[model samples]
Each structure stands twice: as C-alpha cells, then as structure tokens.
Target: MKKIFSFNNIKTLLAVLLLCMGSAACKKLIEIPNPVDRLTPKDVFKDSAGAVLAIEGVYLNFGYYELSQGAIFNGVMTMQTGLLSDELLTSSADNTFVDFANNTLRSDNNAVASVWSSAYTNLYVVNACIEGINNSTGISEKNKQQFIGELKVVRAFYYFNLINVFGPVPLIKGTDFRVNATIPRTPVNEVYQQIVADLTEARQLLQPAYPTTGRERPNLHTATALLAKVYLYQQNWSGAETMAKEVLGAGIYNLETDLNNVFVAGSKEAIWQLSTIKSQLYQTVEANDVIPMFPFMIPKYYLSTHLLDAFESKDQRKTKWTAVSTMDIDGVLTDFYYPFKYKNNTAAATPREDYMVFRLGEQYLILAEALARQGKLGEAQPYLTEVRVRSGLDEITPATQPAFLNAIMKERRTELFCEWSNRWFDLKRNGTVNEVIGAIKPEWQSTDALYPIPLGERRLNTFLEQNPGYTE
Candidate 1:
C-alpha cells in the first residue's frame, strides 16, 4: 500500500483536518481552503459535530475529481469499461479512451493509475475516520457506532472496487502509515472476506433510516444493498438472494416507473446518492461529462451499436435514456446515439441531479440472478419480470436454467450500464470476459480481466506486484 499522506500533495494531514472541519459549514466541500494550521485526529474528533463532519468529509472524497465525478474512476471507467465490453464506443481520437475501448491498456494508463491512487487515498480517509470515531472522548456510543458503521461501509466499498479491478489487493484496515506503506497484496478471497465482515458489522451498526434527508449517507439498507452485491459477485446465491430480498422487503424504496426520473436528485429509487455541489457552469460532473452538445460535436463517448441493438423496439429505456445526433458523412446523413441518462448539462440555481450509487431496481436484478443461478427459475421469474415490466417491456419467462441465467445477465447489462463499471465487472465475474468481450475486442486476453497495477505504485512499494501480462 502507498503512504496515504504522501500520495497526493493536496491531501496533507493539516489539509485533511481542515477539510473534515469545513465539511459541515461549507456548501461545497471541494472548495475548502488548504490552511497550514495543524491538528491531530484527536482534535478534530473531540466533539460530536466534528465527528459528523469528518464522516461527511469522506463523502466529499467520493465526489472528488479523480474518484467519481471528474470521469476518472466512476465516469471514465464506466465509459471505458462499456467500450471494453459491448455497451459503448469511442467517439473521439483520444488515446486514453481508445486504449480502453480497444482493450490495449498498458500499465502506464493514467486512468488506471487514477483509479488505484484515488481509491487508496479515499480509503485512507475512511480508515482515519474509523480510528477517530472509535477513540473519541466526547462522542456518545450511539454516535460512534453510527459514524464507524458508515466508515466501514465506505472502506469496504473501495476495497470492493479495488479487488474487482486489480484482482488481489492490499487490504488496509488501520490508519497507520508506517504499516500500510509496506503491506503486500492479500489474496482476493481474503480481501472479500474482510469486505463481507466489514459490511456485516456495518449493517448491524447502522439505523434503518438514512442519516440525512438526502440519502447521501449510508443506512442499514445501503449496507444491505452493497452486501447483496458483494454476495452476488462471490456467487453466494443464497446469501445474495436473502440480502436482496431484505432490501426489497424493507419497503423504503420503489422502482421508478419513468426511467428519466431515476437519475434526478431525490429520486425514490436511489438508495444511496452523491449530493452534488452547486457550480456556476456544470450541474453535476456526470451531466457535463455524458450529455453531448450535439449529435456529432465530439462527446467524450457514445453508445455502442451492440448496446443499441440489445434493446427491443418498444423498450422505453432506449428512447428515454439515450439521444440521437445527426452528422453528414461524405454525401449521406449519418446519425449517432449517446447516453442521455443525465440530461442536465449546465448548472442551475439548485442541483438538477445527484449521482446514483445504489438503487432499488438493482436489488430486483440481484435477486433474480441469485435465484436463477441456484436453479430456482420458478422463484426467479417474478423478480426479473418486475424490472422488465417497469421498463415498458413484456415479462420474460426463460424455461431452461441456462436460458434464465442468460436473461438475468442481459437484464443486468441493459439496466446497469454506465453505473460503476457494472458491465465490465459482470462480464468478469461471470467468467465470460474472454468469451463475450474477446469476441467484440480482438485484442482482449484472459489476463486482461484484471487491470495492471499502476507502475508508479509498484515502484514505490517493494511488496507490490504487477498483474499478469504487464511489465514494471
């Protein structure tokens, strides 16, 4: 693991203290100052309010430029992985994107580096928060549990992304820079076991109700939803089914009938969302990143033909979630389609959208897949039908187990695209990366399932090792 404080110049210990303190008062967390005033972790977590602010500060880290909003981890990885799969196509000549689209990624790819660095950097904040909350003198036991619960989920979430992207990764649980700097990669299964342990504890510690009105903070259901996903990735069918059913049975969320309403701020479907900071120009990073100015105005990415063809003619998602543009190609008129999931491109007086992290619709799919994988097709049909019915499509009834599994996979691909590298990870976890993605991307190798560890990180940490098929 890389030393947390030294990883980014903007994230000094003093700056981190101020950033945590500033989260409660500032309207925008990222715009906080970098003052030189020094304070230990104890100083910041001395009060209940400061502890709350420190936890909120971790949410700000999630929305940072390199992580989710700025198209490095969530935004860029979503598009690039879609391109790597069959859901997206490169719309520009940018080599950074084309490499992902083409499955020719190298160890030096900046996006891969950003994903690695940002994840670990944010994980450091979460670990520190966990330590502070546990050792606080003035904070109540109830408050400590709530804050620590949220921090554990955040920590597990980063590890979830790390292990999925890079295979085995160092599982750093403490905030000790000296210990973490020299840690070696843990086995992928061991890392997942830690994730499961963290989330299970988090589920117990969290309240049923969301901490804040915005659903920006993780609650019991949020932890449950993430745990369901972790179980699904591990192919723990019964566990995944039970967890998904738990979230569904809670009755706190509903599937959005209107697909267009799902991504907007305060949607009932959103289980956990990232609250956006108001800006003079862009409403949210996703809106500015995805919505194109015109049909052929060189958007960062566009929907792939394969993805466009996956939808049925009457599927409302195709019309509601995507847009078409016209361009003149030589003598004939050509049209291109782009993801229109986020429609607000410019900033408004208030935020038009918040980034959706977890939602109710995905739970249904998880339940469907879990049941289908366990050979319980009869029990799975209704859950799969629920998602399809909401999307204005006919209910599917796959007779055979293999057919039902395929249906669930297809539903996941269409429903969850462009959200948190879902398609990429799905193809990987299903062991079809070489079969499905390789057919589309000729250069794709079995070893390409996991991305190369960032070269700089490998050099800095002697214990770190590169993934297969990459050179240091």
Candidate 2:
C-alpha cells in the first residue's frame, strides 16, 4: 500500500466515505502530480473565503477516516477482557501473545498497535492540509490565520485522543513526515501542552458563531468546549468551569426535546456530528454499532455487569445501551445484548444521519460537572436535570461534589456512547479505567492506558517514536 505522507509525488486520494455502515464507496481527489507552490501565508489566507473552504474541507474529510480511525474501542470494551476471555482482543499480533488470557500486556501487543498508525496518520493529513493552506496564495490573511488555528484545534482533538489512548506520543506539529524508520516516545505532559495550545488558539480564531452552527463541524463552540475538556483532563477545574459555562450561555444548542432523538440527528441538540447519507449507509446493522451499549462482538464489549446495573429502572438509557433479550435463529427469542442506539441496520444504502461528534447539549452536562467541582452546585442542578428529564430519569439534588461528578459521568455514558471518544477519555480523565472498571477486567495494565505506537508508523518514520514499552 502507498503510504499517505509521500509528499514528493502527486497521488490520488482514496476518499472512502463512512456514510453508512459497511456501504462505503471510494472517490479519488487531487489526482494530479504533486507541486510545491511557493506562496507566503499572506497570499492564501488573505480572504475568509479560502479559509472557509478549507474548514469546510475539514468537516467533509471526517467521513473518509472516522470509523477506521480508531478500531479498538469498537472491538474491545476494555483491556481486562483479554485476561478473562480468550474471545476478546483478536487481531494479527505477529507475536506470541498470550497476555489477553493472562490479563497482562507488554508494550508490543497488537490491539494497541493499530491506533498509533491510524491516529498519527490522521494527524499527519491534517498537518499536511494545514501546511497546504498556510503556503497557498488563494486565501485571505485573517481567514488564513483562523484556518490554521482552527485546523490545529481539530488536530489537537485527535492528538488528545491519541495521548489518552497511547500515553506519551512523539508529537508531530508540522507537515514533515520524512524521518528515519523508527522514533522514541515523547512525554505525555508534552502532548498535553501541545493539545492545550492548539485548542486555545482555535478558540481565539473561531467566530463566536459556528458557520455550521449547532452542526457537527468544528466551530467556535466545539473548540472552546474542547479547551475546557482538555483543561479538565489536566485538572484545571477553574478553567474547565469557565469555558464550559461560556458554551452553556451561548444558547446556540439545547438538550433536545427527547433524549433518544439526540442520537437520531437533526435534533437541535447536536453541536457537531459525523454524518452519512442514505445511499451510503450499510444495509446491515452489525454487532459493533455504537448505539445501545452491549456490542455484538461478545468479549470486545459486554455490558459490564456494573454498567448494566448502573441505571435506575426509569432511566431511558437501559433499553438502548443494553439488550436483555434478542432474537436468534429460527426466530427463537433469546436473551442477549447489543448496541441499541444504532441497532437500526435496514437502511437502503447507509444510515441517513452521520454520527454526531459533538452536541451543544453535552456541554450543559460538562458545565454542571465543572461548576459543581468548583463549588457551584446550585447552578449545576438545572442543567443536569435537563438531561435527566430528557433521558426519562428524574433529576438528582447532589449535595456533594462526588455525587454530582458521578452523575455527570453516568449521564455522559448514557447519552454520548459510540459517537465521541467519551468512554475512553472519561476512563482516563477520571482515572476510572483502573478503578471503576479494573477489578472485573484484570487484564488491564497501567501501561495499557495508552495504545502502543503502531508498528507500521514506527517502521516508516524515524522522527516519530514508539510509545513506551513497545519494541520494533
């Protein structure tokens, strides 16, 4: 396969649209020879129009890479299953890997390997686009700066996903992908710093109003929302609370009239979405769709006995995230579980709606948690209740921070599963991967918190380093 970073040659971009599940068709873009157009940043970003087009490209590009971008989450609920069940975490390791049954992992495992290549490849593409825009002469000056900043912000979102998944990463901030065959890991803190800087700049450059307003494209709101989240990841509660509330007050989004509709698209609740059209959607609903919790892939994700038990009887989430009963062969009724949110697989070509990446309503919950953590319980209650009521659960009156935060976390799980990288991030940011989920999943390792840098990436770029504990 031709690697994406061969900047010296013009190649056709294989645009595989992730519109509907399993029903993708590829289109080739930029099918000409590569040329190094010499132009100052001033020449390109001089008009907002070019910058706008580039931003449009960013949202459009997501369909090409979103699903395969990160696969482990779709495949494994948590690393612990590797120890408890042999069925979980199956893939080509090219190494004698008995660790899953043993519940312990070395740095070189296959599950962690795919992510390093996938995410970095994505970052590199974004970087290439950023560089292309920076040097192009067709855009306006002010828009040029904003476009670069905005792209970095989105890139940071992807990088943060990498950092949380693969621990420390060799941070690549430029378009240059030329380096030796293997690289060493950079520190986690450094990765965090870069994400923060990108988001901060993004927030500054994005207009207060999103051009896709309340849609699933990165806009001023999503950018700020991410900054607050990154701050929370870093334990900057005050900053988290500040940014979270700013988004809340903006009033561009809502909690949705019905909680179920939040995932069903066209709901005013969406902030940003990963989208697909009808013809592009897959005809079959697989066991891996992010909706309704229990995945069809058995060990990859079974509703944790804990997760299954988390909801109260009236909680609307239970019916979708977990499948207590299902139909089997001969049309026999058997009790089992599968992802319910995206369970509808009979679309003609693909799912009609794109996966929502961010929603305005989600920030309300974030604000509730942030404010509650910062000692603003009274202000947090209504926001929390909006989601609770929408989800068919009664609101809680948390008198303490732990209670409030716990509610926020659960709400997020029930509301946002499979669309965003919420589950993984929440596990890391809350330090719950090892705690709330650890005992049942004994195979999880502190090191497994981060994905191992992919072997292919290691073999391709010397400048990029392998994440810790992995070997070439």
Candidate 3:
C-alpha cells in the first residue's frame, strides 16, 4: 500500500498549506528546498509557441484535487478543506479512525493553506499565458483571445476553490509572488468578484461545445455550470437558475442511464475535471487522511442516523446508496448489506480514477436547488427527478420552497459523495452547519467554520492575518 503522510501533525500541515507547482512554484509555495529555476515568465513568453508550453503546464502539473483518505483519493479535489472538515487527526497512522463523537477538534489534518497557495500558482501561470498572448503578436488574434478566455476560466476555477476554502485570499494576476507576498488579503467579496469576472469572460471566450473524453479542459458548458455554482454559493438564486437552465437546455449533457458511469473516468456527465495528466495520481491519493476510512474505505458514516431515518423506506436511493447491517446473537453477519453504489476499493486499492472537478449531474442539482429556492419547486422537479430516477428513487414532489430546499441539500449530499468537501461546506452555507454537526461533534463550534491560516504565512507576510477566531 502506498503510504500518505498524515496532515494531523503541525508539520504535515505544511504540505496542506502550500503546493509545489513547478521548479519556480516550489520555491514560491514551499520552504524546505531551494527550488530549481526551470523557466521565467519572460523566457517562457518570448514567443507565441513558448506561451503554449507554459499554458500546457497548467494542465500538466495539475494536482489531484480529491485528496481524501488513500482509497478514494485520486480525484477528490474537494476532499477536505478548512477546519470544519472531519478528516483524520495527527498521529492518524496510530489511530485508524477518529471517534467523531468524542474527538476534541472538529477538523482533521487538511486546511485551506495548500489549496490557497496552489490555486494562486495556477492563476499566475494562466495570467502569464494571457500576458504572452497579448505580447506575442504572431499568433492569430482570435486564437490568442480564445486561449486567454480558456486560461481565465481555469484560473477562475482555481480561485473559486481557494476562496471557498480559505475565505478572502491574496489575488495575484502575474508571476511576481515573491515580491507580491507583501500584498494583503483581498476582501472575500473582491475575491468573488475576480472569480465571477474570470468565469464571465470565459463564457464569451469558450466555444459552445461538449467534449466527451477531455473533460479536464473547460468548455462553454463547464463555464456555464461553474457560473451556476458561483451564483448559488453567493445565494443569487435567479442568476444560479438562469445559468443552470442554460446547461439543461443545451444538448451537451444529461444524467447517465447508469449511475455508476458518473464516477468512472470518461463519463458523459462530467463537465470539467482535474486529470492526472503530467503528475502521478498515486502521490496525491495516498496522502489523504479521511477518504480511505469513512464512507468508502471502511464505511464509518452509514448515512447519519437522521438521514437514514429521513428517507422514505421505499426511496430508491436509500436502498441503492446505503445499507444496514445486522449481526447474529453470536456476532456473525446475519445478512451482509452496504449503503452506497460508488465503490472502488481500487480507488484506494490503486490510483487510477481521475477525480471529477465538475460534472453535468451536479449542474442539474444546482439547477434544482436554485429554482426551488426561487419558489419554483414545480419547475425544478424534472431536474431533481432525472437524478432520482437514475438512482432508482421515485420522483420528488417538493411542495413548498423550504421543503424543496431541504430536499435539494439532501440530494446534494447523497448524490455527490467522496468527491469534495461539498458536504461540509453545504451545511455551512445553508446555516445548518452548527445545528446538525454540533451535537454529533461537540468540538464543532461556530468559530470552527473557517480554517486558521498557517502561522508561517503570517510571519512571512505581516500583511496577512488569520481568519476570524484563529490566533496569530
């Protein structure tokens, strides 16, 4: 088995806080080694062809986004971020699983640090590509501008994931991070502005197309899906619904008849995703702490008691997605049962599956939630039912806005599992984070929502400050 370092230690937190993009990136993001300087932005952008190489590196050096426990690790980009996540603790190798009810800290080892750093590195790379596109005049104007749009959406995705995890962060649009360390944290609102800005520009840049095999690269549909999510996260139901409906109406995507196809690589539903192209997927997944043991690895969370009880007994998802176990009086299995369909012991068993960064199924759900919140539950039913019927569940019939919203959240949690930290963030965004996990985890106070920015960055850049309730 490939061994992943524990993020539980204050030391491993170092990796969790920063990322090593390339030789240049390693120096800017990490401290241990003197990173070898491979290429400079000026040297890279000296020609239009040179700029293409640098842009390719953005995809080439992509890290495994889904850093879950080793098992379901490869593509879980949204695995765990921030302090509210329930991942493995420090000394995780010694302790197999954390006792959620008894643990003192609500967080596992991962934090928003590395995610924030790596995304900026990506932004810098993309922005430099735009710089080259603007400067190197030989390339066709249409091609250069199109490349810029593509690069911006990719950068916007990076920033969106970072802002989601780290709250307000430094927004750099160039390759001067060494000196730019002095730049202070941008307001969270401003960060969102940048994300929205990048994506909006991408919508106009990307061609209206659907790519079946190469979902890693952003397409028009992917941009649309991302805009839908950005609006939903910002609580702009109308904006969210409008973009979501566009994707639904666009003939580019649909829920796969086979639900299992959703998680497998090369599925039709994936919009834009992170692929293990230039990097080894094994390196990223093995380092995960929480992904291997719970849900998929050992199945610790067998549908929260409330969730298992909430579903109607006949609900197809409950039967297909979850399982209940009963032991004989002699402590032997009376009948074996399991609760989920996306089982890939091989995901932990081996690093093969590419994580889905964005997919069409999620877009549908985003549409459902956005529409339902807009007091259009009846209109949202078809999107909700498409996923439900595919999962073998009966069509949903949410009557009121509140009921529809609650069902949408449940649908999100159930449909999107082991992919990202969406489960944790969903509760936070819905204002039910404390209410639901508070009793299950007494350590999860309201202050625990955002992560404590690494103390190192605070010293490196005095302009930086910790998130609320975290000590410097």
Candidate 4:
C-alpha cells in the first residue's frame, strides 16, 4: 500500500502550499517540514506575491505528475478511462492497464486510488487558496475576487471529473479537515449544482481575455465553454445551446483547418491549456507515451481496434490523427497504431504542445448536439457540418432529429477520442454503456458503469458508500 498522508493538520496544508510553490523557497520549505510543526495560513497569505504563488502552486502540483505518473489534467482520465472505454489497448500483460482494459477495476486498484487521491489533494490546495485569498488584506479586493474566481473554477473542474467517474463524491468546498473527513457523498445533481454555481460566478469575475500569457489560465469564455458542457451533460439542451453559442460566436477561436496543428501551443482552437516548465524538453505526455522512440519499438499503450473501426472512410482524422509503427513480438513482426495528435517525444529546446484541456472543436460539437436535441435540425446542420468539412468528410445533413443526434454521437466519438475520457462519459450519458460494452465483453455488468470508490477513502471516512458491484 502507498503511504497515506493526512490533510487534517495545518502543517500539512502549509507544507503542500509551500513545497508545491516551485520557486526558490521550495527547498527551504521542504527542509523544515515537520507534521507536528504548524504554520498559520496568514503567514503565507500575508503578501500579494505569496497569494499568487499559492495559486501557481496548485498548477505546479498538477504539472509535477505526468501522464505515466497519473496526473489528473490528462493522464488518468485520458488514458485509464480510455482503456476502460475501449479507446485504448494495453500491449503487455504485466501492467495494471490490463485491468482497466478488461473492465475489472476494484476499489483497491492503485490507479483508481491514484485518481481519487490526486483529485482530493488538488482540491485541498484550491480550497486553501480560495480561503487564503478571501482572508488576505494585502491583496487588492479586485485581485482577491479574481483569484477566488479562478480557484472556484478549478475546484469545479476537479469535482466534475470526480462526480463523473465516482458517480457521487464528498463535496469539500472548504479546507476544514475535521468537517471534510466525515462528510458523506453529495448527490450527483447537487455536486453539479455547485459546479454550475462556480462556473457561472467565475464567468462574471474573470476578464474576457486570459489572465496570463497563452491560454493556460481559465478566462471568461473558458468558464462559458465548460458550463456549456455541464448543461449538455444535464440534458439542458436550451442552456447548452445558449452557452455553446456564446463561445462559438466570441470570435476568439477558430477551427484549425490542418489537423496536425490543432494541438500546438497557443493554437486559436485551444480554450484552456496547461503548460509545465518542467516538461519543456518532453513536449507532452501524449507524445512521450504513445510515440515509439526507435524502429521496432512497441508502444506501451496503443489505439484499440474498436476506436479505429469507428472512423469513417476517407476521414482526415483517421489518417492525420493516427500513426502506425512496427515491432517484433515473439519474433513475429507486428503493426501497431497509436494517437499522434501531439507528435514530439524527444528532448527539444522548445515544446510544441501545451496539453489541450478545452478547445473550439468541442464547442462546435456541443452546439451541434444541443441544437439537434431541441429538434432544430436545420439550424444545427451548419455547426455539425463545420466539424465534418474540416475533417475532409462530406457535410452531413441528417433529415430527422434522431439521425442528427446519432450523427453527432459518432462525430463526438471520433473527434473527441482519447480526449478527457469523452467516449467513456458519453456512453454513460447516452445510456448505452450496457448495450455497447456488453456486446464487446461478456463479463460486463450494468454496475460496472461507475468505478469503485477507493477503499482507502472508505477506511478514512466510514460515511462513504461504495458503488455497486465491488466487494467490500
């Protein structure tokens, strides 16, 4: 078992806040680390620079863990969920990925625990930052509000993934560990209510333009785009259409004509991206893990045949977004396919991709699906066709609402494949988990739609209940 750390201590909060700073004080802070030693939150938030570092620390913690190490930003959701959803296949039998591919996850599974623990760890940091920002007198009211808004939106992002994967999770909106440790899981709808509230207020607090260089930080449009996705998941079609249209019409982003350039840093297609100074040499985790380094080198994870078969004929995505390589397995030459969306694996002076979080391409699909769900087939046709035309596929003009909805789902599966577990979440949202996964795996069960709540968490908080179909 991995060593479990408690966030109940004020010292724990200070250590995480300081150690994650990634600045000159990081080494100094770590040297004095002691669980029994306590530091007041005011000591850290006493100045504006400290306040800024507190927030940056949250992002640094995200960057500290890469895809191979289970970073929440792109790793666990994009890869583990991909394996569970049939979008990816594990190449070796010795790895933990086989459990995900086989859909036999347990509460004790380390990867499952990693996703749960990592999210809560970040959440604690974000919540502490929000509280510190509010209490700090050194920061201007304007900056404090903006900082709180940013933290809230980040908190929403964490909860969004937790609620989606775990079904229901304890909503820890504050940094009080005593209260947090015993809180029962909040209902999915209530958790979403908090997410909507966070994003809605964040949109009002954030400026139209990004706060920092590039599109790394969440901006006004970023909140709107995420809210649109939230509404779509809730089946609020009109709300989804309104929010999605706001992003699509903002004139800030454009659909990249060239598929190869979409994932590049600062691309107009990106709504929100995350960058790591530490990864300046590695470029991106997607490239490092998916691309083979040498001839006959097999990738650890590759695209599944199920995902490859979903693409239409002559589709530009199938050709441009995927790549093929050869390897020798048991002395027999074998061909393998993998995602090549971000194609830089070797060390370089400058990085190419920033790990896309939200992009304009998804907004187009959201708008198309929302409009179609509302029976506005003709109005939705152009939005749907916009994505298709860029992919070198013929413009789709589905005559019926059902046909348009079906078309949108297919496009979503192909366009958003291996992205943020879109395919896994889509199957659950569309109520097709049983129908789709059952046909593929004979051992599939309806309850397998939701992963088991980590057993460590259950041991920590007795109020927590496990998702069905897992042994206690």
The lDDT leader among the candidates is 4
- What residue pairs are clashing in model 4? none
* lDDT-sorted candidate list, best first: 4, 1, 3, 2
Clashes of 2: 42
> Taking the candidates one at a time, how many backbone clashes does each contain?
1, 42, 19, 0
Per-residue CA lDDT of candidate 1, range 1-472, in tens?
3536452322334435544553544333333343434346666677787777666667656653222522233465677677778888866787878888888889888878877877777777777777777877989988888898888888888888889888988888776677788889999999999999999999989999887778888899999999999999998999999999999999879998889889888898999887665345665666677777765665667787888888888788888888887777788777678888878777673437777889998999999999989999999999899899988999878899999998888888778877888988988888888888877777878888888888888887889988888877
Off by over 4 Å in 1: 1-15, 18-38, 64-74, 277-280, 349-351
**Model 4 TM-score (2 dp):** 0.93
> Residue 408: error of model 2 in Å?
3.2
Ten consecutive residues with minimal summed lDDT in candidate 1? Answer: 64-73
Whole-model Cα lDDT of every candidate shown, in order: 0.78, 0.56, 0.58, 0.81
Give Cα distance to truth, residue 246, candidate 1, Å: 0.7
lDDT digits (tens) for residues 324-378 of candidate 3:
4444536654432333434443334332345566778788899988888878888
**TM-score, cand. 2:** 0.76
Best by TM-score: 4
As for candidate 1, its clashing pairs are 71-76
Who is ahead in lDDT, 1 or 2?
1
